[model samples]
Every structure is written in C-alpha cells, then in structure tokens.
Target: MGPPERTILGSKASVRRPKERLEREERPRRKITVLPTGRQFAVVRMDPLAMVSHLDLDSVAIEEASAIKPKKYLVYLDAPQDLPLPQSQWCRFWVQPVATTLRPAVPEEGITSDMVLPIHPNTQYAKGRRLMNCTPQFPFPHCYLWIRSMMSLRVRTKRGVDVYDNDKAMTVSIDSHVAFMSAWNEDSRRMFALRRAALSSLSGQTPSSEGKLRKSPSPEVVQPNAEHSPSFATLSIPPPLRIYRDGSASSDDEDTSQASDDAESPHAPTLPPIPPLMALAIDTDVFGWAADPKVPFVPLVDLWFELEDHLSPDNIPSPVELWREQETIGA
Candidate 1:
C-alpha cells in the first residue's frame, strides 16, 4: 500500500502548540462598553502660572495679609434648578464655608485696579468687588467640586464682601490649590493601582541575600546607634606649630600644619543629637471617599490643610531659626 502505509514516527499531531496561543485562549477577555458621546467627559485645561500671576504679591505684602484675620463666608454653588439631582449635589457637597481677606486696590501705591481683581480680565465672569484673597474652609471638597464642575464654579462671597446685591457678589474661581489634584483617566488610575500593588507586594518580601549580609557583618564593627552618639561640646583649637631645628622654617611648617588641619576638619564637623522619630498616627478612615473604589479620584485636601497649619505664621520658624536648625543637623 503507498510506501508501506506511511508509518510516520514524528507527525504534526505530536507537535506541541505555542505557549502564546494557549495563554491567549486561556486568558479572560475584558468587556469594553462603548460610552455614548454625551456620557464622555472632558478635562478642563487651566494655566496654573497665569492664574497664580493674578494673585501674586511681594513676600512682605503676603506676610502683612496673613496677619489680618480672614473674614468667613458661606459660598453657594449656583447650579441650574432644572439640573439632575446627582449633578446638583455639588451645590451642597462642594459648597462650604470659605475665608476671604480684603485686599483693596490702591492705585497710588503702584497697585492698579486690575491688580486687585480676583482673576485676569480675559477670564469669563471675572468680576469681583475688589481683589479679595479666598480660601475654602475644607480645601478638598472645594477643589473636587471645582475640578469636576469644569472650573466653572464661582466664589460668590456676598456676605463676606458686605455686598447684598446678588448681581454684584464677588464671583471668582478657586485657583490657589486647583493644581493639587488632577482629573485622572481610567487608564492612569489602573496603572497607579497596579504599581501600588507591586510596591506593597515587594515590601512584604525579604531578599535571600539580606539574612546572609546581616550575619556576615561583625556586630562590634557595625554600631546601629553610631550616628546617634551623645551630644558633646566641640572646642575650636588652632593646630600645634612644629618647631624645626633649622631657623629658616617654623612659620612655613606652622602654616602647612594649619592648612592640613583645616582640610581634615573644616568647621570641626559635629553630629547633632537626633531626636527620636515619633510616628504621627492618623485615622485615615475618617475620610470616607479615600478608600472608596467607586470614587475614582481623591483630593489631596488632607495633606494641604495639615501643611497649611504647620506653615502658618504662628508655627513657621524664621530664616535665622531655620539656619540654626540646619547647622545643628550638620546639613
């Protein structure tokens, strides 16, 4: 029969399939639903530097402004009455107590009328009674609202600015910390989540070499607390002069010795006593939205306020004090 029935030892049926094809077949397919054109959201572009320029002031002026007690006001988000309930919730959720300081435009002191305006004249609805510096009582909610609402929400401070007329109310956008949070897309959020998971997994695992390296080092040679030695007073003494037998060169020897000493111990480098690091335990669960997977974005409002409190005039250290602190740290 056709060449002894063609008894093929290695047939195509015996060959193994490619790993990539098998993996692709075994992999779970992700369902991607096409969103309607109306459902698609767009990120509003903002020029942070341009916005900051509107609120620019000299350091001395800023210091003076900080001294003045900020006037409190209840800012209201004027959303359309016919708007859907979910969309209108921003009026309550985002709108909160805000503080504003009166910064009147003085034309005489090189401060023109335009300098006092809340925003640049080119911006829409950029009218304000005067240039009033505004900050939200709760920065996160306000920033979230501003970002989500396409930066269209205005700061209508009628009571704070002593203006009863709704038409003339100080209508300006919150531009101070707008750059803190961004409207991240789904892909960005997914990538961030993956990276965070990878980092967390790596943190729990100990490398194989770690234990060996730890045991290899001698205990006496490697002091764990060597950097944290007790504080001692350092004395600044000139290098001892070498008196050579030849009369031609005691001064040169002294100079050379002093140069070498200076090079070896310039500033007589001293390690400062490092204070024990006290962990500040914070209850993050208080922020309900932070851990919520449904809430795609979380504003960095928590960090902003904490930093603001520390950087406040009362808590802030002077330049001289900072210099002294740096010297103590040997920085």
Candidate 2:
C-alpha cells in the first residue's frame, strides 16, 4: 500500500493539487464596478483667491461685486470625473462664495479702488456640502450626488468683480497628466525653498499665533560631519590651470597632475559664484509644459474645485491610436 502511494500516479496528484489551488487564487481579481465613473459639475466661477495658499479667509472681503449673482451658465465637467478614490470613493470638493455674503472687503488706505487682487475677498466656501459631496459615503455613497457645482457664482476682485457665466466658460475633459506636478512641487526651487523654510521654522522659533508666515533665517552653509570627509560641498572644480600631456587621473586631488590655483598660471574661466539656491533657481523651468498652449492647465494646488479627478483608474485615458488612412488593430 505504501509503495502504491509513492507511485507516479499519486505523485502527479500531489503536484497538481497545489498548482491548481495557486492558479485559482492567482486569477485576476475583479474590480468592483463604480457607476457614474465620472461627473460633470459646474464651477459657476473660478475664485482667483483660491489660488493662494496660506491665506486667511477672515481678513479678505469683497467690498462690492459686479453682479450679486450672474444667471448665465456655461461651464460643465464630465459627471463624476475620474477621482483618486476607487470606484466608490468620494473626493475633496468645494466651491467659492458658498455663503450669501461676499468675501472680506479690502482696507481702502493701501488698496486702490481698482487693484485686481488674486483674492475673492469676503467670499466664503459654499455651505459645507453645497459644492462637491465631500461627505464620505461607505464605498463613497455621497457619490450618488457625485459632486455638483452650485450655479450663479460671484467672482470678485478688490474693487469690483466679473461674473464667469457658466455658459460662456469652456468645457473641458481632464485625464491625469503623465508628469504630475513634476516641475513645481516635486522638483522646483520655489517649492523646495518653501519646504526648507517650513522645516527651518519648525526646527527653530515658535511661530506667532496670528498665522503669519515667520520670516525664515537667511540660508547658511552647513558643515559636514568628520566621518563623511570629501563631501560634495567641499569638492570644487579644480581650476584647469595646468593641462596634462595625457595620463590616468588620481583618486586624490593632491596626486592629480592639474595645476594649483595660482595667479602665475593660466586660470580657468572665472565662473560666477553658484550658490545652491541660485543653481536650483536657474535649473528650474516651470515653462517646460508651455510649449503647447492646448495642453490643459493643471493647477499646482491639491484642491479639486475645478480640476478633473484623475486619481481613479476609471479616469485613466486610453492610448490614442494614430493612422494615415488605415491602421491595424491589435489582435
């Protein structure tokens, strides 16, 4: 009986059992179908001030708006635009002038009558749930409402305001950009400087309760530790004073055949001092995406008031197929 159990027939069954189990388990998991994959919401108007971060809403005021409420409706987005959440997750959502009151008024002494401020002063966010359905539903139930924009918005300025008629504004479809905020937040001087400033602020003095951004201390040269000698900061472009006839370079600068920085020798081209910040500022080019005007503008901010929801898989776009007269479709 034991010999029979060890036979090729038994061995085959033993091998097949686990392999079949694994195949079953490894079957591609089904993605739950999230209905209303996207939504088209109307952003009655764009609030210029929403563009600015770290702004205190309490102080800003809309002294007077051009129109209390513009009746026109022009702009609309695809309903339930692909969002970061799964099939059923809601997204961060809100709109300007949620309140009946306009934004705060500008103090007249410093503010002229017609200065265009990047702020929707005195305007408030639409009541908590008025704009997008931020209220999270189990698997994103609020999605039934699927985030809608209130009509009749008042876009305001310091002295006056212009109403963006929903009907006049452009309609746009948003697919996730392959290079998501690459130049700005991920790798940019302004953002890096800001992060450094924030870190320095936290590490150094306590900030005032008034919510003012504390003036950051001037940048300083950080000395390297004793163990990590020959740091990048300490390394300099050895002036190309002396040219080599031809030879292998040495690991140590002292052993190299290059000439010392001596006035008697022909000097390397005098390069202006390149501090790290200056080097970074010059290296950063936010305009890289500006080569084409048709490319939709993706706001650097995290908010989703007007921008399309791009995080969800459903929102991901299919590759465009190009052809002259006819092209073969993949089998």
Candidate 3:
C-alpha cells in the first residue's frame, strides 16, 4: 500500500460517466402543436351617427352620404380568437358608434317617415360555455329599444303642440361605413400580436405588411479577457510520464552509428525489434465565475483529452473485445 492507499485513475472513467449522464438527460424534448377555434357570441350593429362623431366637421364631406340607401346591416363581434384563461369566464359588450362620417341628428328635425332605423337589441348576452352561448332577446337588459321602419310600422300621432317632433322625418345623415367597428381588449390584443409574429416568421414577411409584429434586437457577441484565456475554458491535468527502456544481449563494441542509421532509415533492408511506448493524457473541468449572480457556467478544458488519448495509435482499445469485457464486469 502506497501512502494512504489512493486508487489509481484509469483511462475511461471520465468518458463513461458523462456519456451515460448526458444521454439520460437529453431524452425528452418534443414539439407541441396547438390550433385555434374562431368563435364569437355577440354582434354589434353600429349606427351611422357613431362614425360621423369621430370626424372633424371642418374637413369632412357631410352631405356625401345623403343619396346612399340606409338598410339593416350586421357586424359580428370578432375577438382575437384567443383568451388568456383558455376559456372566457366573463363577457362584456362595448358600444362605440361610428362618428367619423356619421353626423348627429339635429334636435329640431324629426326622424323621416321613409328612413329605416334598425333598433338596437333590447337584451343581449352570451349563450354557450366554451362554444356558442345564447344571450337574452328583447326587453334589453341595458338600453331602451327603439325600432323604426317607416313604411311597415304604424306611426302614432302625439297631441302635443310641437308637430315636428311627432312627425316621422329623418334629417341627420352620415356615411354608412361608420356602422362597422373592430372589437378587441388589451389581453386579446397581446395574444393576437404573438400569433401574428409566429405566422410571419413561418411565411417570411415584414412587420409592416402583417397585421401585428414583434421587433427584438440581435444578441451581441463578447470578446474574451486576455488574462482569463486558457486554450480550454477550465484547468487541465498534466499528462502522465511515460518511460521506455530497451535491454538486449548485444556486443558492447558494436558501432553506434550503424545502430542509429538502422533505426532512422525508412528504406532500410533490415528491421530491428520494436520498442514499447506508453502515452497517457488526463483532463478535468473547473467551474468559472457566472455573469449572473444566480447562474453558473462550467468551463470544460481538457475534459475529453483522456478519451481522445485512449483511442490514439499508442493506446487504442480493442472495440470488439472491450464489449465482452464490459459485459462480464457489469454481470
């Protein structure tokens, strides 16, 4: 026993340990695919007046929409088709009339007898849980219902002094485009942006053309410090010393020049007995200071040196016979 009986480190010890560990850890990394279901519950029938209100009266063409025929139209509520919670737990209806092109009705003028003003739903709510849920119909939970179809619905005459208010006359006119609106909340907007980015990345499109896009800066490459530079990131082990000795019963008076020539000549007609050569290389990795306080990066310097050395011409292991040896050792 030498000193404290320390065990001698063999060649493949480091190689087998990491190979087994890395293979086990790298097993499960698969891709996931998800599809979106485009469904919505409510519809908002915007009024022409809403659009007119948003426009600047000084520059707008208010009289341009006078000849346009007004009819009942439908604008389905199109949410971004995705929600933060997977399922929508709460529902709300936001109403904003188109004001850019639709002008508000004057107080003195009355709704026209020939004009068609589709009444807003009296009561509206969602119906189904995950898919299609039905909201309430009639006696609207929120607004006062006003349905007016001058030709079909009978008009009631009021006995008040003001006959103009009682008379069914449509005076205020706004552009028809003001009757449509886009629906989305803050969370929905964010998810829509993410979806748009993913689609754009797949199709190779610019941000401006896509409905929504993301802009992220590229990572910067850093230069290494001269003081900290080692060929590898970590500290390496020194190679083992190999000693070769040749002993032969030969004449002591033999010419030294002839022996040297026989060993060095590549086309020599005669050959001498080969000498035994031993080669050993060992490697180890040391930990380095982490850029972040919580995370650490390991530096692998000569970690693979021993493995590469063992497979060299001087130390090549028998592959076919090594498996049998390993089986016996494991058994």
Per-prediction TM-score: 0.16, 0.17, 0.16
Q: Between which residue pairs do clashes occur in model 1? A: none
Count of clashes in candidate 3: 26
Stronger candidate by TM-score (1 vs 2): 2
Supply the TM-score for candidate 3.
Answer: 0.16
Question: Each model's RMSD to truth, in Å?
Answer: 31.1, 27.6, 40.7
RMSD score of candidate 2 (Å): 27.6
Sorted on lDDT, best first, the list reads 1, 2, 3
State the displacement of the C-alpha of residue 316, model 1, in Å, after optimal TM-score superposition: 16
Candidate 1, 1-331: lDDT as tens digits: 2222223456533333466467889997532211111111111111212222224335653444334332212222323211223222221123221212212222112221122112222232223232222222222111111111111211111223332232222333444323212322332354434434444444553343233322221111111112321122211111112221224368978999998797688677666755444212123333222222212111101101132333332332211221122122111
Model 3: per-residue Cα lDDT over 1-331, one tens digit each: 2333233467532323555567889987432212111121111211223223334433333343222233221112222211223232212211111110111111112211111122233223211111111222211122211111000000111223422220121111222212212111332354445545555675698545675534332211122123322121211111111121123224433667677778789976665644433111112111121122111101000101122222322322211122222122112
**Weakest lDDT window of 10 consecutive positions for candidate 1:** 296-305
Candidate 2, residue 185: lDDT: 26
Which ranges of candidate 1 are over 4 A from the true structure?
1-93, 96-164, 170-331
lDDT of each structure? 0.26, 0.25, 0.24
